[model samples]
Target: VNEILDLLYTNLETYPSVRTWVFQKVETVYTLDVRQISGPQFGLCFNASHLHSEKIHEFLYTKLSSKLERDTLALWNLLISLLAPDPSTVTGVRLTKYRKGKRKDNTGTDAVVDYEMDNENLEDGGKILDHEAEIDEMAVHDLGLITVVCQYLCHIASIMAHSTNMRCNALQTAIGFFLEASNAPKTVCELLAHSGMSVSAATTSRMLGPLRSQCEMKLKGLG
Candidate 1:
């Protein structure tokens, strides 16, 4: 399991040709949709656009929550779909995204079935086993949207980019801050400021405060 996960975290593509647009927003609840133009692959075309911090943060906080089951096919599909494209060996690839319905689905989001076979030709019995559960992300026009897989990969990359000592020091810093407000945790403001962030108290209390709690709750639930 560990090896499989590591393969996914490292082999998955960090960037793809897709743009996310905010579709509907009701109060704090947001429904984001993705619009993609798939060509040959990464080397096929060039569409360079920046990602929106606000949107991507929202996606990570909400979608990448603890709901992801490590033992199930959800992680498998996500990692496999995000796997680096190989136009050479891979015969064909199909991506199917399931939309939100009346009741919330597995992983608490839509599922995408990513199909891939390595046969030289599609005629032979080269069908791969079908895995389940998937997700996507949101962004603005002209700018590219980060896929859900890439988003999680980015999180992993951030940790991998740090040295062992750097990671330890960073965790120690986080622990210190976490212990500081272990009891009556404030949403943002002083805590974040003390952590060397430039977030304003008002903004933290009104906006990020809730968002922080949401992400924390999601993590706690996963545990």
Candidate 2:
């Protein structure tokens, strides 16, 4: 199971297009399972002995949460989709005032609906109004929004550049074979696999020196 999971995480970048679909399908499976187990009519038979078992619920939740965290690229894609301006909303004419409900002519309605739907789906969407200026003002007020957006974009760039050198085979082999291995050996092998390199331990150590130094410098700057 760990090997399978490590493999999935390693090749996640290769399936970028299908990542969203995969996430949705996984969510759907969980939802269906939850519904079947907890539904009123089926609750008794499934209770404790079957789907509603405490152990199973805990395991499922743990797996889902871990997957959500590990699948950073998928989360980044979701964030981009959320932040992107809807095509339907970009109109030549800016209405001086906004009103709710369907427009008599459906020409501009699609854009409005799309924008609203996206906003509504967001975690804090309810707090945000449909006003363009209001949304911009909120974004400006929240420095965290800027920080999060920057971090997400940086992650996307790292994935695109394949900078992390975190790969499936190396991860799986490390987890599967080196459960008892020393940290130094595991780290060295994983790095080699991820980077597709054949460097000696001394060379790998030398390469990390500058990277660590840069990180410390940035930390000091932030401080």
TM-score per candidate, chains pooled: 0.19, 0.21
Model 1: how far residue 160 lies from native, Å: 2.1
Worst 10 residues of 2 by lDDT: 43-52
Candidate 2 residues 84-131, lDDT tens each? Answer: 545444221122112222352446554443234343334343333466
Quick one: best lDDT, which candidate? 2
Query: How big is the positional error of residue 75 in model 2, measured in Å on the Cα after superposition?
Result: 17
lDDT of 1 by residue, 10-121 (tens): 6546212111111123211211100001111211111112212243223332233232223223333444466655644323422211123312365676554444444443
> Which segments of candidate 1 are over 4 A away from where they belong?
1-83, 88-90, 95-146, 162-223
How much lDDT does candidate 2 score?
0.41
**Candidate 2 TM-score to native:** 0.21
Number of backbone collisions per candidate:
0, 1
RMSD of 2: 23.3
